[model samples]
Target: MTTPQKIALVTGSHKGLGYAIARKLAQQAGIQVIVTSRKEQDGFTAQQRLATEGIQVDFHPLDVTNDSSVQQVTAWAQKTYGKVDILINNAGVNPTMQAEEASLLTMQLETMLSTLATNVAAVARITQAVLPLMQAQNYGRIVNVSTEMASLATIGSDYYPLAPSYRLSKIGLNGLTVLLAKELQGTNILVNAYSPGWMKTDMGGSDAPFTADEGAETAVYLATLPEHGAQGKFFAEMRKFGGPIALTW
Candidate 1:
């Protein structure tokens, strides 16, 4: 019997790390990639760009922070694919460059709240929306895009900035991953988080040392992990260690 195609949904894939992850996932056999963006035009543009590369993927308008939008996309995926095998929570924001981000005392409460809303809460929102589908199929691979800066163990020693908002949000994301994996224990649905490192993306900026494609390496590995693979673990970029290496949470 032929294996059925797995449907993978990648949030905020219009550009940057998400786009690179989406592209790489689409390249895999037996997988249908769905590229989503908050802006419809941007998603369509990304869809076209990938098409030019001879890669075809579905497109959807998804604002992870919007309840209706998340519901709509989940409904579409269920109606069209009957199942969502993978979910890559790649959508996030980093306000480290802002002046307020330099110090916790100066960080605006609004900025902190917004960052948490997107980087942390939105992941929860979309995952909650998609989990039932994965549960129904008894198979899923969830890769949460996180940062090394959020690693609590290395926070005091890292050379990165004190962008309190971004760091705290990702910390929450890490906690979410661990807790979700605990809840999903004894199941095929594996959820894990990984640091993409400093990549050359809109958030990483041009001066960053790594490319988004390089950053996307770990995502592909986690998304295609075999049954009973690593769960609730934090991983570093695969390129950095030549394979998936667990990071200190």
Candidate 2:
């Protein structure tokens, strides 16, 4: 019997690292990539852009911060694909450039809450929405896009800025990854988080050294790990280290 194509859903993939990851996954055989964005036009534009390159992918509108949007997309995936084989929680926000984000004392409470809503809480919301499909198939690969700045070990000493909200939110995401992986132990559904590093994207800025495509390498690696592969671990960008290496949590 021929193996069925895997359905891979990537949130906020219209541009930047998420787009790079979606394009790479769609280029691979036996994978049906669903590129999603909050705006329908952006999603369709991204789909068209890939089509020009002979890479076909589906598009879905997903607002990870909205419960209704999450439910609607999950329903669409279930009806269209029967199961979701891969889920990349790539939708996130970094408001570090805001003056208030420069320090914890200056950080606005609302900004912190909003960051957590999308970066941390939205991940849990969407993961909870799509996990049933993975459970049904007894297979899955979940990759949470995280930043090494969130590492508790290096947060204090790292040269990176104190962007309190972004760091705290990602720390929450990392925690969620660990707890979710523990709950999924002894199963084919693997969940891992990886720091894509500082890449040149809208979020990373032009001065950054790496490209989004380069940053996306580890996401693809973690997304397509073999059964019984590393689970519940944090990884650095494979491009930087030449291979997958677990980062200190």
Angstrom error at residue 202, model 1? 0.8
- Compared to the true structure, candidate 2 yields what TM-score? 0.98
Q: Write the per-residue lDDT of candidate 1 for residues 1-249, one digit (tens) a residue.
A: 213899999999999999999999999998999999989999999999999999999999999999999999999999888889999999988888999899988999999999999999999999999999999879999999999999999999999899999999999999999999999999999999999998899888899999999999999999999999999999999999899999999
Quote each prediction's TM-score. 0.98, 0.98
Give lDDT tens digits, candidate 2, residues 47-150: 99999999999998999999999999999888887889999999999999999999899999999999999999999999999998899889999999999999
C-alpha displacement of 233 in model 2, angstroms?
Answer: 0.3
Spell out the clash pairs found in candidate 2.
Answer: none
Tell me the lDDT of model 2 at 166: 98
Which residue pairs overlap in candidate 1's backbone? Answer: none
* Model 2 worst lDDT run, 10 consecutive residues: 1-10
